[model samples]
Target chain A: MPEFEPKIVAFCCRYCAYTAADLAGSMRLQYSPNIRVVEMPCSGTIEHGLILNAFEKGVDGVYIAGCNLGDCHFLKGNVRAIKRVAAVKKILDEIGLGGQRLEFFHIPASEGTKFAKVANEMTERIRQLGPSPLNKNAAGNAQKEGGQTV
Target chain B: MIVAQQKPISEIAQMISDCKKVLFLGCAGCVTVCLSGGEKETDVLASAIRIKRTLENNPLEATTFTCTRQCDPEYIAGIDNLVKDVDAIVSLACGVGVQYLAERFMDKWVVPAMDTKFAGGSVVHGLWEEKCGLCGECILHRTGGICPIIRCSKSILNGPCGGSQYGKCEINKDIDCAWQLIYDRMKALGKLDKLMEIQPLKDWSKSRDGGPRKSIREDVMIDE
Candidate 1:
């Protein structure tokens, strides 16, 4: 049997987290290859339905990476994202998905090292939790696309 | 507009515990304006239910649709084919919408996902306050556009009732005295003399006390 490598989706804001991920790659930062990044104009635009849709699509875990407090390029984008993430977290727990499976990180544009650390942390956490219960064929399919970011 | 809040997901899940497929119906009228039962909320609810059922190893197939106004029979008629295969319907509209669905689709089990709260408008982005009492009468003309029936702690027509203090109601310090507002408005309009006149007893029969009421427009009715 193939090993279980959880698939994680990361919604990253272009002004901060997305750039930080890019810098992480340039800096030779070693982290788990389980993450699939979706770049957004601002994390505030992250809809609760979209995160829930990702879970329904069978992702093992999901996270939003936005700017640090008072650092959003759009003034309060990260602030808005934080409140939205909290609301979605509550909904996820209500739906029996375990709110811990979803997370939010405040990573500024220069925090390449922090971005790598978050990737490793989320990967290890999800690996211990195993694949999502929604994924019926998780054991058979998790390793099929181990390093793909789609 | 009617304001409502969505029921807890646990309660909603319990309602459909025995069903394998369901349709989530959202209303685009008052519920939509209140940010409770709209198209986006319908989709989110469907996803949540599907995820919950899948996690429990009893996968549920969910579909979503939004109507312009669920209270109207014409909009309900449009979804005849959509309800053909669903085991139950989860209505995200207010009580009226829920009843309409139940009446229109007698074979399907209809459940409400929101608790119909009150007839009011949004005070802020996410805050709603009850403004009207739905007393089956309009007395805004008499009270300077403020309502004493719903806003006052006690529905006294000639209010201030010895409970008003510092422009606030005696029930809670946070609530403004309704009669105070009426006085201020009337004073500003130079119509404070209106307050001196004694008001007669209200006709309670016009309100919900009279039982379920109906409005008919015979002139607009089509000849059969």
Candidate 2:
């Protein structure tokens, strides 16, 4: 049997994690290719519906990376993001999707090495957890249609 | 305003487990103000149900719609077209809204997503406290704008019950004795003499004990 590779979606704040991702590329840091990044103006802009939408679209794991605590460019955007992430985690847990599948991290823009590290860490963590139950059938269908597993 | 809290997702999921498709109706009224049943809550609930049913292989198709105020007939009338297509409805409104919607669409199943809590206001963002007892009477003027009917654990109208100690209710130490609040307010307003005036026996007929009640304004009635 071929190894299962999980699909992970990361909502990265433009002020921090997005810049960190760019810096990681320039620094030639190696990271897993499975992470798909959606750049947002601020972490506070990541709504509960957007995270749920990602799960609905068959993503195995979701993470929000934003500026470190007390370091947000918008004063309290990261604080709001933390609360939103906690709220979404509770909903995910209640819906039978383990809360472990979702994560929130504080990262500085200069942490290019840390950005690559999180990508590989999240990819590995999700791979161990396997695919989201919501995506089980969809993954099967995709393999049947595309003649390959994503 | 009416305050409410959402029922657990597990209980909600169980209520509509037999349903393949459901419409989550949100109210932009009291429930919205209390942060329980509103547009954001409606979307969150729809997504949660979709995820739960999908994992179970039952695959629920959930749709969401937010009305101006579910308790108002005019607002609910606007969603009649959407209601006809769904098998069941999960109304995210106060008890009044849920019953109103159910009565309006007698043939369809309408279930409440929120548990109507009380007539209250927010103490702060994300926190609400009961303030009114809906006793069908107003006595705030005599009590220095503090209500003893609901705020008092024992509903004592005359004075603080013997159970009050250190200005806290005996029922819960966290709760302040309503009479204490009234006394303080009365003192601040120089209306301490009002407490000496005996209150008359409350007319129970004006409240829920009088059975289902209605208020009609003859001037607003339309001739047949």
Candidate 3:
């Protein structure tokens, strides 16, 4: 059997983690290639529905990278992100998806090394946890056709 | 406003486990203001249920719709087409919305996603506290704008009962003694003398004791 490689999604705030990812690339840092980075205006804008959407789409793990407390460029966006992450974590646990599959971290723009480190760490954690239970069957693929809005 | 909280995701999932497709209906009225049921919430619930069902290998097809207000028949009429194909409905409004959907779609299985809590206003961004008991009467003027009926531990007509201590109810230190609040307000307004009068027994018949009540405004009625 081929070694399991976990698929992860990272939601990064433009002013912080997103820039840090760019810097990591500039520095030639090698991190796990399993991640898909999504840049957002602010981490606070990340919604519970979006995180759940990722899980429903069959991602093995998801994480939100935001600015440090009191360091948010928008003043309180990072703070709001932290609270929202906590809320979604609880919701994930309430569903069969363990909250361990989701994470939130503070990564400032200057921390390229930290960004690479977190990327590898999250990838390793997910690898050990294996694929999310939602991905156990091929049915999960068909379920991703997404919900309709009426 | 009416306050409500969503039921646990597991409970909602269990309610519709027998079905393969469902509609998550949200209300834009009180439940939306209270953050329990709204468009955003409806989407989150749909996603969560889909993920849960997928894990169980049962899979699920979930759709979402948010109406202006679920309690009114006029707003519910908008979803007639949407409900035609779904196996079940999960209403995220207060209990009223759940019953409205049930009454409208007699053949479809309908369920509540929130537990209607009380008549209250938000005290903070995310915290809500009950303010009104819905006793079918209004006595705020006589009570100096504080409602002892709902705030008091015992709903005492005239009181700080013998249990009040440090302006807090004996039942729970966290609760303010409603009569004490009324007294303070009355004193500040120089209406303390009003509390000195012996109060009359409340007419219980005007409240829930009168059974389910209704109000009709003849001027607004459209004769059929």
Give candidate 2's error at residue B12 in angstroms: 1.1
Q: List DockQ, one per candidate, in order.
A: 0.86, 0.83, 0.75
In CAPRI terms, where does candidate 2 land? high
Off by over 4 Å in 3: A136-150
Candidate 1 chain A worst ten-residue window by lDDT: A141-150
| CAPRI level of candidate 3 | medium
Greater-DockQ candidate between 1 and 3: 1
Question: Measured by C-alpha RMSD in angstroms, how accurate is candidate 1?
Answer: 1.8
Cα lDDT tens digits for candidate 3, B75-124: 99999999999999999999888999999999999999999999999999
Task: Output the TM-score of candidate 3.
Answer: 0.94
Candidate 2 pairs with clashing backbones: none
Residue A87, model 2: lDDT of 91
lDDT of 2 by residue, B1-224 (tens): 99999999998889999998799999998988998999999998999899989888899989999999998899999998898888899999999999999999999888989899999999989999999999887888889888998999878788788998999999899999999999998998888998898778888789888998888999998799
TM-score quality measure for candidate 1: 0.95
Error of 2 at A123 (Å): 0.8
Report the lDDT tens digits of candidate 1 across residue range B52-155: 88878888889999999999999999999999999999999999999999999999999999999999988898899999999998889989999999999898
Off by over 4 Å in 2: A136-150
